[model samples]
Structures are given as structure tokens and as C-alpha cells.
Target: MAELYSKARTKWACRRGMLELDILLEPFVDEAYDQLSEQDKLVFQRLLEVEDPDLFAWFMGHEACPYPELDAMVKFVLDRVRA
Candidate 1:
């Protein structure tokens, strides 16, 4: 029950208002989030706290995420989606 709730909350957080962010984040949360380590999962949650525009820029390659941990996680998510 707790795990399900956590996943549900995470999924909810993944839903940014922008369609592009929704497409990338929703599917990644569904498919890949479960595979993450606990620390990595925390990083993902932190990523969700980032503003949509920054996330869009990071995901679209318009700008690099300045934080290394978040940047690495962004690349990891992108690579998984690409694969």
C-alpha cells in the first residue's frame, strides 16, 4: 500500500503542465522509475521540483542542467527513453 501510494505520488509529480514534459516524464516514471536505486529515486523527485521551463530546456537540449546530479539524471532519463 505504501509503495503504491509512493509510486502514485511520484507519477503525479511527473505531470508537468507542458505536453513535451508530460510525454517524457510520464512514460519514464511508468517504465523506468521502478528500476532506480533509492537515492536515484530521490534525485528524480528533486528533478520534479524543478520548474517546467528548466526541465523542458534540459530535456530538449536547449540548455544544460547546472546541477551535476540533476544533469546526470536528466541524461540518464533521456538515454533510457532513446533506448
Candidate 2:
């Protein structure tokens, strides 16, 4: 996956705004995934890949994230990173 990511570097590097943050987050995601369940891993994968308006909502807990697949991960990542 790293090689694929490397090949896609140009595309990812050109991503705008917070999406660029996701590119910086790849390493942390790898470290964190070691402790996650298979189901949660799938959720994490989707959370990293998808761009939804509510994607970061659950992180703040100011609004509820309706996407069942990513809500737990959004919360978990927020708790882990504290931001």
C-alpha cells in the first residue's frame, strides 16, 4: 500500500485543505489499526477514504454523525488524538 500511495503522491499532495491532513495521517492510522477489530478496521478505512460533511462531526461531539460506519472511528480517532 505504501508503494501505491507513493505512486499516488502527486494526487494526494495536491489535495486541498483538511483533505491534506488525511495524507499526513496515514502513518498514525497504520499504528492505530494494530489494536482495532476487523469491523472497526473497515470503518477506519472508510473514514479515511470518504469525504462527508459529518466526517468530523462526531470528533467534536457538537453534532451527531449519522454515518454508522464511521461514527465510532471518528470518536476513537478524536479520543486518541485529542483534537
Q: Which candidate's lDDT is highest?
A: 1
Question: RMSD, each candidate, Å?
Answer: 2.3, 5.3
**Poorest 10 consecutive residues of model 2 by lDDT?**
2-11
How would you encode candidate 1's per-residue C-alpha lDDT over 1-83 as one tens digit per residue? 34633778999988788999889988898899889988888888889999999999999999999999999999999998888
Q: Write the per-residue lDDT of candidate 2 for residues 20-44, one digit (tens) a residue.
A: 3454345445456566766675566
Which stretch of 10 consecutive residues in model 1 shows the poorest summed lDDT?
1-10
Total clashing pairs for each candidate: 0, 0
The Cα local distance difference test for each model comes to 0.89, 0.54
> Relative to the unseen true structure, what is the Cα RMSD of model 2?
5.3
> Model 1 TM-score?
0.92
**What would the TM-scores of all predictions be?**
0.92, 0.54
